[model samples]
Target chain A: MNKVVLYMSMSFDGMISGHDDGPGRGLGVNGEALHAWLSDGGISPGSHRPGVGVNAEVFDEMMQTGAVITGRRTFELAGGWGGDHHDGVPVFVLTRQLPDQPAPGHARYVTELESAVAQAKEAAGDRNVLLHGGSAARALLDAGLVDELVIHLVPIILGRGRRLFDDQGHRARNLELVSATEGADVLHLRYRVVSR
Target chain B: MNKVVLYMSMSFDGMISGHDDGPGRGLGVNGEALHAWLSDGGISPGSHRPGVGVNAEVFDEMMQTGAVITGRRTFELAGGWGGDHHDGVPVFVLTRQLPDQPAPGHARYVTELESAVAQAKEAAGDRNVLLHGGSAARALLDAGLVDELVIHLVPIILGRGRRLFDDQGHRARNLELVSATEGADVLHLRYRVVSR
Candidate 1:
């Protein structure tokens, strides 16, 4: 069975991005004061540049099981890719405006959050589902679709920014910590979502 | 010269509390799963008990500040008081819908973020101002009024909760790391806000 997971970063105050849709204000954007710990990790957390991080094992594990899902804003802010194959993994973008099949070899866009999740499960096959950011993740969570979540807490506080989850309703999903690794500013934590 | 500072723990995915409107969700309702590491702190981060970690030197320093600010939610969640008084220190409550003032010392509500900043600065006299959360901290940051930020990154990822900053707007503030202390699952980091 595929488990849906939400993994992301937030500020000490609990904000996902800076205010006013400010560019570069994601999570600890203007306030990297706390999150500068991630600078040691090289590239920024949201940037999808490959071949980074000395500890890619966990990220690799998180990615190996399923297709990636994200919102359009997240897709564009990370400087949307010319090609969608993330280290050879297919990605499904949740957007109401994009085409059903944005790319044949690597990417596809879907409007319905349910179908996107279902397709992601299908794509995962025997592996678990890794639910990426944007509205889709919130939608899945609100619908009680996600099973597990792994959060890479980068020490930073934007004091404002696009929230990882705000107003989006999600039923309580009890969780058990599977592992914890201390990286510079990013604390990698994996959890098994146990139903209470 | 009031140096406004914000300090708090947040989820990896950017939530401040789980089920913010639900019972016991004000502290870590959905965040319990994400912040399980705080358990090692001998006191859960969301205990909401006044003086839970009040004995720390950091807490002493924080309490001695000239001014303190927080959102109404936090004030209410904290059950009004947390032991000692501010010794006539000026405490500002950031809110549009003001609630009845808590007993003992004095608290004034401000609807405008800039006014609150000005008031905090005036109240500080010569001391630094401490900007705490619910949403008032976010409002101040959104206005680019905060002078410094100190975040205690607890090593836990609450899978669900209210976020620190979501898609608001604020300018980038460069920061210089002044200290890093590993206390239980929380990493206490202090930074001087830098400018572009």
Candidate 2:
């Protein structure tokens, strides 16, 4: 089965994006610091910048992902990922309405989350389906569709922002820690979603 | 200087207590699972039962703490630590009103947070002053008084609860990860509070 994985960068306080995260800003106001580990020429597709430590490992893992599913806000905020999917993989955007003309990359829009995840999984084949954006990931986790959660735990605390898990009355879920690795400026935590 | 350390157990989603956290229930609804690591005859002052791994380590660390300061709600919810301190350490409860009579085992009440912390620090002497609750810890952190923050990161995700960093509009603080240790059911994370 193609595993549905929610992978994202988060602050030490568990904020996925800063308070002002929106269309113009990808990660919100001070959130750029959260991705400093990747700014040093790490794994960000096409740019095979020589990276070391956990950044390289995370890059290699992301490179192997088959399809990416993201929220409409994240897709728009990222400018449709610069007209191309991350490493040419198929991208599915979970949105209520689709644009008249789709962008250049292999992007698809779906009104429903389950169908978007299903289509992403089908597109991913045996490879892992990567869920991007905190809202998208939270939706998947709430639906019990996420098989794994990988967090790049940045060491900074953005005291106020959009939290990764913002569901007010969501159900409790159990996670088994699979691995914890240290990077230059981030802690990579991989957890298997045991029970939702 | 007596290091002021904010130490608490937190859920994976960063909640320090459950939705129904209050008197008679220390961790709140369904939060007992978070402290199962400490229930198996580990370090609890009088319990000298043979314990190994993280529970013992936490016990030893708690034993070394000279004084503890906590919020009024936490103190009341815990019933004044069952009428006694955890290990006979002087406990300063931050509250607006003082009780008619102080609880047993060196418990003191202070109307102000700064004075409570100061009294705890003074009582601690050269030893470490421990902040015992999420609200108390946040107050200290907001005041730039917390020198270190130690979290016992439990793996369960309580989707809805009182978060440790619930102070919205609070200043963003930086943290340096000093250590990360794995326990049976929790991950012990020690971070140096970098800035206010």
Candidate 3:
């Protein structure tokens, strides 16, 4: 089975992105701080930017995913990831309505949550699906669709912003630790969702 | 100088304790799930409980602390930790006013944040001070007083609860990764606060 793994960079307080994350300010005020690990490393072949230590390994693994799924807000913020998120992989955007132009990329808009997850899984085939965090993560976790979670725990406290897990009527979920690796500016933690 | 360290077990969403975590319900509904590792390990000498794998080592280090500082609410919630939080060490309870005939234990009430931290450090001498999370942790972080943070990153999401880090009017703070250790039910991450 192709696992749908959710990856995000979060602060010590759990903010995935900073406050005011929208069209004008995609990552919000100082939201890019969470991705400091990617900026502090030496990039080898097939790597995006420069990621030091475990950040490089984690980013490499994410780049190798077969497909990418993101929510509408994040999709718009990223301007559709130029249609393909990584290495010619299919990008599936979960949204209620499709944008007019979609920034000239290879992203396909899907209306229903189940359909998007199913199509992304099928597109992934043998490789895993790279799921974005924030609103999309909450939806997938609530629906019991995420198979694993890779949280690059940033060593800072934004104190406020968008959360990754949830704050609504969510029940207790169980997970098993797959691995924990230290990056230059983050702790790379991998957990397998056992039960929701 | 004695270092003031904050330790907390947090959910994937950054909640330290679950909803309704006061008075009667200490850990809150299903909040104990974050502490499964403590219950899954063998009881080694000096450990508070049976902690599997890294949990035992973490617990042992926590028990060796010379003093404990906690907020009034958490102090009341733990029923004062029988007055001595661990091994007869002094307990510094931060509160606006002293509790009338507080729970039987070795707790002293301090009305000011600086005073509480100072007293804890003085009492600890060369040993590290174990500062509780929640309000005290937030205050210490905001005041640029905390030296290190040890987060036992649990694998569950409670959805709603008290967060360890502040959310209102808090600036970004930087930290350096000291180590990352994986336990049976949690990932033990130690970080040194570098910037405020």
For candidate 3, write residues A1-196 as lDDT tens digits. 8899998888877888888787867787768888767767455554455645566778888888999888888877877776767777778888777777553466887778888889988988999999995888888888898899998888888867877765676766788888888777778788898995
C-alpha lDDT values of all predictions: 0.59, 0.81, 0.81
Docking class of 2: medium
Which has the better DockQ: candidate 1, or candidate 2? 2
- Report the lDDT tens digits of candidate 1 across residue range A129-194: 666765666677667677766666544545455555555454554445566566544556566655
lDDT of 1 by residue, B1-196 (tens): 5588886665444466665445344454555543443344444354422233522545556766887777766765655444223656766777776556543356666667778778888888888887777477667765777777766554443554566655544444445556656544455667666552
TM-score of each: 0.58, 0.93, 0.93
TM-score of chain B of 3: 0.92
Q: Cα miss at A37, model 2 (Å)?
A: 1.1
Which DockQ values do the candidates obtain, in the order shown?
Answer: 0.18, 0.77, 0.74
Clashing pairs in 2: none
In candidate 1 the C-alpha lDDT for residue A42 amounts to 46
* Residue lDDT tens for model 2, A1-196: 9898888889988898888877776777778888778756554464743277768878678768899988888888888877665678888888777778765568877878888888888988889988888778877888998999888888888988988887467779999988888888788888999996
Q: Return whichever of 1 and 3 wins on lDDT.
A: 3
Docking class of 1: incorrect
